[model samples]
Target chain A: SQKIEQNSEALNIQEGKTATLTCNYTNYSPAYLQWYRQDPGRGPVFLLLIRENEKEKRKERLKVTFDTTLKQSLFHITASQPADSATYLCALPTDGGSQGNLIFGKGTKLSVKP
Target chain B: DTAVSQTPKYLVTQMGNDKSIKCEQNLGHDTMYWYKQDSKKFLKIMFSYNNKELIINETVPNRFSPKSPDKAHLNLHINSLELGDSAVYFCASSQGQGAWEAFFGQGTRLTVV
Candidate 1:
């Protein structure tokens, strides 16, 4: 069986500090790995996606690194703020061939305290 | 101008009742999906429709069915809902099967009494 695991415990960080989240998977080689942010009671918003061929991708303040060798992806929030508090989910294509069929991991809850 | 949207942000109903949650996307995407988020926040895909055709169907129960009248809509209907069916259901749309980005609607939290 395929499994995607994110740290279940909440991550607490002081505002302005960098927050890093980890995502590990087993038995699936997804061509694309995507990240999303979900605030309380709201749908997840797509943040960034990195392909297996690419080592890293970046947005305004978000950075994602995909390591197929270790089967891990690290998400970093630089210059984090209180507004960055949310559950971050990592998803991949279900069958590796169907990109629309996504399988999501239990998100890592991030809390930035001011 | 919401890309994807679901109706009835909160739904409270009793077991054995039938209910439907409507979803629509104006993004002109070719694929749409339904995902369930459990109490522990584990998200899983239940169905996927592309161009109004069923493309992916997971091990979901027969009580739950997805109806895609057109390419822009995918509705989820639950019959004889059970207590275990209590979860947040999300509707999303993507450009195509091989696309990596998906836009999600604000989920509808369902409570089975």
Candidate 2:
């Protein structure tokens, strides 16, 4: 079975610092991986996505790196602000299934202090 | 305008009751999906539909059924809802079935009493 795991503990960091979150997977090779930001009492919003052949992808202050060898992906938020405090989820396409389905990680809660 | 929208943002009902969560997408996407976010904040895929056709059905219970009448709509109906069913349900849509970024709705918080 495929499994996705992120840092379950909340990460507290000061504003302007860089926050890095980890997402590790087991038992499958995904075609692509995506990251989402979810606020309290709301649905997740898409952040960035990286394909298996890509080493890194970036959008503004956000950066995502995929390591197929380790089956892990790291999400980075630079110059974090209080507005960046939210749960970040990592998702990937399930192997041997329809491309529409995404297997998500437990997510890591990030808190940015001002 | 909201790209993806769901009705009954919050639903609280008793066990064994039947309820439905309606979802509609105006993004013109061909694929829609239903996902459950548990109390622990773990998101799991429950069902997926493309152009009103069932595409992906995870290990979800039969009590939970998804109906897609058209490309823009997918509704979830739950029968004999249990306490374990209490969670937030999210509806999402993508441009196509291949790997693509998904837009999510506001979500329906279902609490089974």
Candidate 3:
């Protein structure tokens, strides 16, 4: 069976430090990968997406890198703040076809301390 | 205004009961979906509807039925709900079937007692 794995443990970091999260998958070749930020008691919000052909993608303070060869993606939050703390999820197309059918990872909870 | 909205942010019901959760999106997207997040915080896609037509239906149980009255609305009706059905249900929309970015609703937390 296809699977997406994220660090089940919560990541604790200083407010000003950079936070890096990893997402690894097996048995599926996705054309692109997406990252989402989910705050407690709220639904997830889209963050950034990186295509397999692209080495990296950036949006403001967020950056994402997709390495299809490794079947892994890295999400980095540079100059992170307390408000940036949340559960970060990595998703891929269910059948490597449509975004409407997304399969999400278990997600890694991030806590930034001030 | 909220882009994607679902009714009854919180629902507490008993087993063997029938219930329905309403969802609507004003973003005018071509695709909508239903996802269930269990207590373990695993979000799984249950159903997908595009242009008021069933597109993707996962290995969900027959007890869970999705109805799309129109392009803007998709409702979920679960009959004889089980305790395992308790989860946070989310409604989301995207511009097209291939669209990567999706806007999700606040989610409805259903608790079965």
Q: Which regions of candidate 3 are displaced past 4 Å?
A: none
lDDT by residue for model 1 (A1-114), tens: 789999655899999999999999999998889999999999999999888899999999899999999999999999999999999999988888555688898999999999
Fnat: each model in turn: 0.82, 0.73, 0.76
**Ranked candidates, highest TM-score first:** 3, 1, 2
Clashes by residue pair, model 1: none
- Number of the top DockQ candidate: 1
Off by over 4 Å in 2: A96-98
Task: At residue B59, give the lDDT of candidate 3.
Answer: 97
Q: Estimate, for each residue in B1-113, the C-alpha lDDT of model 3 and write its tens digit.
A: 88999998999999999999999999999899999999999999999998888987999999999999999898999999899999999999888886468899999999999
**Interface root mean square deviation per prediction:** 1.3, 1.6, 1.4
Error of 1 at A111 (Å): 0.9
Cα lDDT tens digits, model 2, B13-105, are 999999999999999999999999998878888999988889778989999999988899999999999999999999999999877899999
Tens-digit lDDT string for candidate 2 (A2-57): 98889656899999999999999999988889999999888999999898899999
Candidate DockQ scores, in order: 0.79, 0.72, 0.77
Which 10-residue window of candidate 1 chain A scores lowest in summed lDDT? A94-103
